[model samples]
Target: MVDQKTPADAAASRGRGGAPAIRERLTRRKPVEELVAETQAAEGTGLQRHMGFWQLSMIGIGATLGTGIFVVLGEAVPVAGPAVILSFVLAGLTALFSALAYAEMAGMIPASGSAYSYSYATIGEFMAWVCGWCLMLTYGVSVAAVGVGWGEYINELLHLTTGLSLPQALLAGPMEGGLVNLPAAAVVLLSMFALLGGVRESSRLNAVMVVVKVAILVMFVAIAVTAVQEGNFAPFMPMGMAGVSAAGATLFFSYIGFDSVSTASEEARNPQRDLPRAIMFSMILVTAIYCLVAFAAVGAFNWTGFADGETSLAGILTKVTGTPVWAVVFAAGAVLALASVVLVVLYSQTRILYAMSRDGLIPAAFSEVDAKGTPCINTLVTSLVIAVLAALVPLGPLADATSIGTLFAFALVNVAVLVLRRTRPDLPRAFRVPGAPVTPVLGVLACAFLMFSMSLSVWLAFLAWLAVGFAVYFGYGMRRSALERV
Candidate 1:
């Protein structure tokens, strides 16, 4: 008798609450505790943890040791001259700040989606969506750009070894006065099918390709060292400090593959321990190799010569050896190596979408896994999109856009680390960034500085892409979010 309410009255009260529910849901934050619990539950049920440190490290190396070294050297060396060696060091330092941040967050979160998942658990839904959107731009465009670079190497190999090559019209995009880059599209499709096959199988293949890639680079370094000319070192900073900074920003794209390691957090057998080590190891290894290769290549051939060669590394080898045989070998190695990069990048893109889909930010179909425990539909969709880009877009613009998108993602990752540390001081991190606040602050600043160094046109394209993402979020993601129902 004490103020009992009827069922209809309770229903009316619920309806009143429903009015604000959309706003509340749209802004809802996924707490780190819940994210951690969900990750544990998912690990117990799906997403097998099979990757060890070496396999994961190989993935990072495989993704990173491709286009930036093979193709970007041609563009960057021309700007900074032999001082491109310092550019490599600067870019590695910038990448290391973010890598350290990623290591801490990855150890704490131990989930896929990398920065996007970190953002959701710390910053809220809106920022998570933004990070995920930027990642899509980064991985998607990178796959295409790397594919185009692979096509160039393939043509160089065929022309050198077989005395035949695809016609220029078929080997380049329409923007480059060609109808389509058939080889680029073909490589993307191949990598797509390899990824769809299974994660374990794809990892095995990537590991093998990584070995081949490292071997060829070592061979190039060994041979080119014998032909070093001190004359090439003159005018080392021809364009001065500004150009070195600019070149470092341009070459920042090379360091991006290390984050792919963090994306595999859910698949790592011991993510908390292995991820941080793998991230740092791969970054250090790649940086060392980059510095060595830059030094060797410039010493073997004039830096100005690199600007004129599409296949820069191979061209340097050819000039050093006084024959095309070594260049052909390098080209073959590049073709195989870049294919691995495409595989890893494409896998990263699928897994990121899978995470977003599971959060109800995208279609649930994307998160659907097959018997092999891979997101088949997501892989297929990502492959198709990347294939189109590879076939029709030129490499220069796509490469710049990829760098901007990646830097944006890196900046957010650093910010996420700082926020998580402040908000959840009690959370256990398997790997902590060396400096609290100081390290992550510098990481954020470094990423921002590089981002601003990008061309204005690339920024405009990035903004347009984000605008489209916002439209999709409002039109579909907001209403469909699983948290809304909760």
Candidate 2:
């Protein structure tokens, strides 16, 4: 007669006993204590922690200051008029609430999965998987969106400076009535190769590019200040509070990349101290820059003027200075800056995949690190996928989809922080969100509000994307989960 075990005994065996045990384990939550142990164990897995606070902060800035200000502003300013300045502040505050929650989670978790890891340890595997799925869409599509934005500015710069342009078929995506976005695809590949060179190299390059990005904005502001006519301030709130809120929802994408700082927790020398500082610092710095740029652009010319241009900043500079030369320079800075955004976004994407793979939720090869201590395989794989997206999809829908995914992830993270505080009060946390439940509650509400502000079409696209994610999780991820194997 075959030996049989009771269900309790089998469940007590941690899912290693048999198929029944494994299936039972699928419903089991990964305890906070176990996740902490796993994170400690991963330190010896060949990924090095070489980043400091400043480098990590630059990564946040480099990632966040790209397409939102450079491209989206062309559309956003028209919605809020001169009051777009308030939109940036409101959006920043919304992001700050979630960023604070993230800082607390990063301090305690010190893991690569960002919100996914936080949710897994505090919530359950299903929620964790959902968070990871949302993030995969957020970062992956964000990289593609930024790449396409870069391509647009580059083509615009060339047209303004040299009277030359790439063929429309090579510049636009199929959705935009073109064959493929070759320039967008090329930028994604470039960022991939840069990442393959290793983290320190990429960080240094990002730092330099960030400086260039900042300098161009400062120069534009200095010039725009001289051109400021009091007349532009007349219709400051022409669109009123509703418009400001709507523009805030649109500008929320600008703040999405600040969370990328926490994704580098596994790669930071002192994540507990550095991660929190980087998150806050990056958010504050980027917010100030955004406010200044919005003020300068709308002050220099009527906000109405910005609606007519493709590259808002560059166009503003050209109009103020009465020369195409400044616009070309601004576009060059934007191109380089947007490339850094792609680099950091792709970096976050690969690292998130690395963390998921290490958990056995995906293929193990993605977790494999190279001699240089980089997830080169994951980077290569992510590059191919994102490159295809950039080449084939239009920028507008991709940006909206990314924003919705990010808002969902942010809401989940806030809930994770609240849950962990109640469930595991004993866990050591280097940082904590002030105001406790209130702060996180606000974060949840704010993210939900922004998410709902998206168009019905965007909602449909987001739901369709999530439906596909769920199918993938059940079909592939569930069976191969490391917890099930255990």
- The C-alpha stretches of model 1 lying farther than 4 A from their native spots are 1-27, 309-311
- Tens digits of lDDT, candidate 1, 1-486: 112347665445443645434445455677777776776788645577899999999989988989999888889988899999999988999999999998899888888889999998777788789899999999999999999999999998888898998999999888989999999999999998898889999999999999999999999999999999999999889999888988998899888789999889889999989999999899989999999999998888888776665537887788778898898898899999999999999898988998899899999999888878888889998899899999999888888889998998999899999887877788889999997789999988988888887778988999999999999998888778776665
RMSD of each: 4.2, 3.7
Residue pairs with backbone overlap in model 1:
none
Tell me the TM-score of each prediction against the true structure: 0.95, 0.94
Q: What is the Å distance of residue 328 in model 1 from its true position?
A: 1.6
Ten-residue region with minimum lDDT total, candidate 2? 15-24
Error of 1 at 465 (Å): 0.9
Q: Measured by TM-score, how close is model 1 to the native structure?
A: 0.95
lDDT of each: 0.88, 0.87
In model 2, the clashing pairs are none
**Best model number under lDDT:** 1
